[model samples]
Target chain A: MSLLNNIYNQLRISHKYVNRLFKERSCYISTSPIMRDLMEFFDDKKNWGATEVKTGRSWTKDDLRIKSNTDLHKLWYVLLKEKNMLYTMEHEHNDQVRLFPSPERLDKVLDSMENLEEVVRERNRAYYELETTEIGEQTHKTITGPFGLEIDYYETEHSIPKEVNAQWQKEQNTKCRPEDVKSFLLKYKEKEYLQNKKQQRRNFNHVIGLLNRFPKMDMEALKEQYPDVDIEKAKASRKYKPPLVFD
Target chain B: MRLTQILYTKIGEWSKKYANLPDRYIKRAMEQVYWRNPKGIQYRPNTVVKRKKFHFTLDRPWSAQFAETNSPGRLHPKVFVEPIKKWSFFRGDRVEVLVGKDKEKQGIVKYIVQERNWILVEGLNCKLTKLDRGGVKIYIQEEQPLLVTDQVALVDPSDLKSTGFEWRYTQSGEQVRVSLRTGRIIPVPASAEETRDYKAKGLYVEQPKDTSEKDLGEVTFEPTLKTFEMEIMDQMGIKEDRIPKKSYWY
Candidate 1:
């Protein structure tokens, strides 16, 4: 029993020594020399409490389109890190009751990320279109709902076939009473009609105001601006008085 | 879908050009949202009650002074602006004053407020105002905006006289302002491209955080038949042996 205990102690010391050596080797094997500690989640120290942190505009879609997939993949992470850092800095500043400098930086990063994603999606779409007849995007369809309003329904993956799924089939079949649907649709249509009429009236009045303000204003430009408004009818309105002529 | 969007569109593109700010930033800085419907099952989903009409003055739309002028519970009188087919006035253009005390005086265009069809000519159309500072009344000359339509006329570069100009295409398909009388092309001034950040785009100083121009200009993309995902996975040495199960999409 004493010998067995001594051997166990020897094994434990070796294990400890091996762990220390492995850790020392890991320190040398680190990919980046700059330690990626928690401090990376914050902005540069020099930028702290700055009034304005000037930066260039966001990356354009055309710029990202020329980058390789690997470059885009790397850029995605860089932008993600920047976004996280900005958010952390913003939150910290808000907590300290300090003004966050250059809030537009966040927007710029977001815009770049959006453009990068769009470029990636475009590349994917092109490949899919070449390989298959479809665009290979999530499928969706517009269908009339129970209230007779058009609803965009995105297709989702299901374990069972749609025809065999009784619960989904029932949900799809669920409908309001015909009379109730008719009443709802009628009210909806009336609301839409009133909105359109109000828009037309507003356009007519605005055109008249323009005419009253600038007598020699370009009529062609006015017509182009307010395409739905009847220019002649608006001119005939009492509110649209013709400019007085003086010799 | 919001009324504020339509109203914001009234801000002319030329007015925003000199600011060198993103459209999103301008919209964010200027927008005054009094109330917004809370999320989840709202009767009018995404309905926002915001300031629809903004009083465009000499102050820029994104400035704090402009925000204060259009602050909550404040409504200015409706301003009727004449719509033009195209904006002709730009910064740094030589113009002759057609009205007021500075009539017939030629000055370079200093500022533009295109929403109101207004321009401020340098050292012209001055309004002297007395300011009280620490019991001392100081008289300062302030530049007032002139109506671009009737109060100012573009100066003919050849004759140095006020003349009407028409936009015409040059032999190289470049649009240019041509003097109606002299038939000489009034080239767009280099200062017209000047923004708050830089005198010109090429002269812009790169910030520390900005990507280097060399990196931006590099073309590293190779024509690959694989999709982005496939290319990325290949680079990472990730292989998928198991095929995804066929599932019904409904």
Candidate 2:
């Protein structure tokens, strides 16, 4: 049924010359030995029992995107099987207390798997947008925290409502109360004011120090550094002069 | 505070970039702002809340999110077939024999001959075939074949490994033996120096920390697609596995 569906979908595609398309171009495999060999990417007899098996980097998104959807789906399973094989081999190698040759092959397979998934997802998203009103599955929502901070709440399915769900209620009810909020506001404002005052003093003293240290300072750069500070007025101050005489 | 400031600047730049974008970009930006939970901003009510129809039942059990306390029945039994990523060989229980008027030969299965349903044997007597430029398929006619005729038997390649198989990392000399049927490692693989380094870097390394509510709260900070996908998992009622926590990029 699924194979028929795939064929039907292929036939439904918009092409200028439909009759010219070859039957082989469609999704069908006549079960051949050489083709099976192509599917199995392991070492031949000579290479078997050998410690290490070398492999190349994974297929990137750009490479995958150029292929047809049917090919991509087939490739997904190939990559998936490859990853599982590598993992099993690596796992066995570890148990035997021997080195698993070409461990990076596993990493490459994993990378290819990731890239393939991304490509599939990109296609899925495009297809979903083209046909449906939604973007396949991802969702988001706003939720208010206990501290009255409004946070986006991602909607999730739950057997029980938020009011009845004991675990979720604990998190929701833990929010700060009005009394706690007022006290938090007071301290938060005080902290901010103190921070600004300290910063102002630091900037003021730094300008004076710059003037004292570099008497012939680059006035333009100084102005760029502390735009609010009056460099000329700061230079005129007694604190601006160097402590020791150059002579 | 510096980090927050930098994040704000980055977000501001992103918002500016999509200021004139069509509906899709605006929607994506809005979703990002919501999920990221940016500080010091009131939640906007301008967007529509898209509700999804989700069916979740506690009785069904979620395999992905919540760990199953018991082994799943044979219906969903985890098959520990050989993973195909690394170099692996299935030691066949029985060997197949190939015979003909020209020659007869046999060999051990170093690997699965998926295409021809044929196995490549170790010590087999056979006539080699050669193709010529004259469009004639020719076999190298040798008076003698390599091996004897008794070298044939149909073996279940799957059944040979009751003792299980071993995976060897050829580069690092690390070996792991796991049961092909059960997927359980009889002798767990030893951690290598590079594996230790990966653990230190927090890549897919298991944490030995005590599992608690505080530990569970750490879920909020995890930047994995699974974090969000867990919502779907919750809907599926699939119990999660208690595998060692390792860093996985979404």
Strongest candidate by TM-score: 1
lDDT for B33 in candidate 1 is 88
lDDT of each: 0.86, 0.45
**Model 2, position B222: C-alpha lDDT score:** 18
lDDT of 1 by residue, A48-129 (tens): 8889888889999999988899999989988998999999999999999998888878888988999999999998889999
Give interface RMSD, per candidate: 2.2, 23.4
Model-by-model DockQ, in order: 0.59, 0.01
lDDT of 2 by residue, A16-54 (tens): 246346445432534322444343544244434566553
Best by lDDT: 1
Candidate 2: residue B235 Cα off by (Å): 28
Chain B TM-score (model 2 vs. true structure): 0.18
Score candidate 2 by lDDT.
Answer: 0.45
In terms of lDDT, the poorest run of 10 residues in model 2 chain A is A30-39
Q: Which segments of candidate 1 are over 4 A away from where they belong?
A: A1-33, B1-8, B34-45, B130-139
